[model samples]
Target: MNNPVISVQNVDAHYGERQVLFDVNLDVMPGEIVVIMGGSGSGKSTLLKHLLGLQVPTSGSILVHGKSLHDVSKKELKQLRKKMGVAFQGGALLSSLTVAENVSLPLEYNTDLDQNTIDIMVRLKLELMNLGGFGHLMPAELSGGMLKRAGLARAVIMDPNVLFFDEPSAGLDPVTSVELDELILKLRDAMNITMVIVTHELDSAFKIADRIMVLLDGKVVQVGTVEEIKRSDDERIQNLINRRPRSNQLHGDAYLQRLVNGEGEK
Candidate 1:
């Protein structure tokens, strides 16, 4: 049996005095697409930071390809990160650099390849992302969807084994969002890359994910296939899926007490 490509065990995270994640656990197999979905404040971003080793969990451990994130030496961690690629929300391209330069940045920094080889590699990725002719343009010249493709080109420039995408469909129109989702599936099929996407776009998630993991109040509510998630009996899960607003319940005395005692943070 193949071991999981990514394992997160009993992770707990906090910010100052407030806990953000609770006993979060997940396993991602090689070449799998796992979509992590949650409302804002559900610890999705915090969890992504932990997965990328940008932040250590307060209580548990994370392993990528079997290497403990916290236990690895700095050099080892750097090497491990070479196998990982992250495409942040909003594209995150360097405004100062042209698209080609941005896409070539990874190869330039990580390899001793000559400029000729680097240019060829950059062209390949740009073409893969359908940004071939736009490479000469600055980041500012691109539209939302083009910027996202440019970011994705930069991310996969290294031919990483694992890819992490944050909100791939966040700001795009419906057509563009579907196009990006199709591109995501194409990349996975062609490259055999393991992917972990953080998104709340239900249609996109259902289309692209092999499995969907739902989070609520900083804890996992369910992790299952799309059909299973749709048929879930959990009220919270149903509420989230149906886009039903949470009912506001009165906690008059408790709320008043908390207000007086300054314990209202929840």
Candidate 2:
């Protein structure tokens, strides 16, 4: 990855005494779409939080555009955040604000731009997202897919260099999910933004990712192109792709011990 936009180096994360991520490492290049995929308890969420600078790693470092985040000042971190954008899984829109107002919130709080300029920029982004006329509508008035699009519009409103998404296709129908995948590809290309997505949705990841990073048991199991992943002979990878239920012999005593020791919490 030449001129990588993100670099994670031997990162290990912990929750209390239990380590959740084990020596994770990856790099994301400019204008590329990288998907981080794993099932529940795979430590994907922990990785995302670390990348967003919401938590510090217990060991190792994360660098965004060559700026180390482990011990950066708050002001410096805020400047780095200004170059990043996130589309949460829930489409977290404020119910009281109109779509246009919601979309304008970033520019309103982050810049000295006036109402007229913010509104114009908001409309432009909404139009780019295929929601130009819907800006006047409330978030409640939007369908699930439309709401996701609205969220995407707001995320890219700042023209961020790195865009992150969490489960962008979680609740939508298949067709809607596919449509959103297309929109994601379009946004990365048109805006020249590096996209990092975390999801359990295999189809969407396979369709949209330039490279896929697979995780298991708090460690990266594999990182490969879509075709390479399909060709993988790893049983874990094959089981995940096939959605095959496992008959792992987890003894009842071990399960009880985990619960007794409070090790079940993620």
Candidate 3:
């Protein structure tokens, strides 16, 4: 493609002796929504950390806007990170701070804006998340869904070009999860921001992904649109999409029967 906003080239990540990601390569275009999906221990989150520069790659390189993480100076990395926003899995907010305070934290550290400007910015972001008057409320006072929304508001407060969401639908009820998915779509369309979502929720993945990357055993098994994935003939892809039990899938007919029965019960 032309110039991807984020690119990963043969990235391999390791934690001590354990290899976490193996030769992962992917690219995210500007204004696109890409979903990374896989089962637990598939290295989806590990890959996300690499993308965010929290964890360095053992081999290969990660680039944001064409600048390699390893090549960038610490000062440059800090500035580059400010250009992106991240909504963690559980809305990692400050327990002691109010909603507005949390939202303004980034501006406080990254900009020279005065208090009045910061307050206005906070209000704008909170209002965008449909949380106009909840600014004064503590994190404990907000519900789980509200907390997620508040965290999203904070994430976008700096008007970042890229937004990273780690399991946005986790810990949410079905209806709430759907609402959050819609919100993600709206953000992409209305704000023209590139979004990278890390999620294992198949329904949510199919609902929001413009492109899907499936990770397995610390490697990318497939990367394509949802339809392409659905039509894939790869055994690993099929098993994952069909929700077959991993251990039993290698055993043949009896396991297939169990998978059929289990899916029917759902």
Highest TM-score: give the candidate number.
Answer: 1
Which sections of candidate 3 miss by over 4 Å?
249-266
Per-residue lDDT tens digits of candidate 1, residues 85-125?
99989999999999999999989999999999999999999
Error of 1 at 118 (Å): 0.7
Q: Estimate each model's TM-score.
A: 0.95, 0.93, 0.92
Score residue 246 of candidate 3 by CA lDDT. 68
The window of 10 residues in a row where model 2 has the poorest summed lDDT is: 241-250
Worst 10 residues of 3 by lDDT: 246-255
Q: How many residue pairs clash in each candidate?
A: 0, 0, 0
Q: Write the per-residue lDDT of candidate 3 for residues 154-256, one digit (tens) a residue.
A: 9999999999999999999999999889988888888899999999889999999999999998999999999999898888888788898666434677769
Q: Which residues of candidate 1, in runs, are more than 4 Å off?
A: 249-266
| Residue 152 lDDT, candidate 3, scale 0-100 | 98
> How do these models rank on TM-score, best leading?
1, 2, 3
lDDT of 1 at 38: 85
- Model 3 local distance difference test score: 0.92
Question: Candidate 2's residue-wise lDDT over 1-266, tens digit each?
Answer: 28789999999999999999999999998898999998888998889999999899999999999988877888999999999999989789999999988889899889999889888999999998899899999999999999999999999999999999999999999999999999999998898999999999999999999999999889989999999998999888888888875447669998889889988475
Candidate with the greatest lDDT versus the true structure: 1
Report clash pairs, candidate 2.
Answer: none
Off by over 4 Å in 2: 249-266
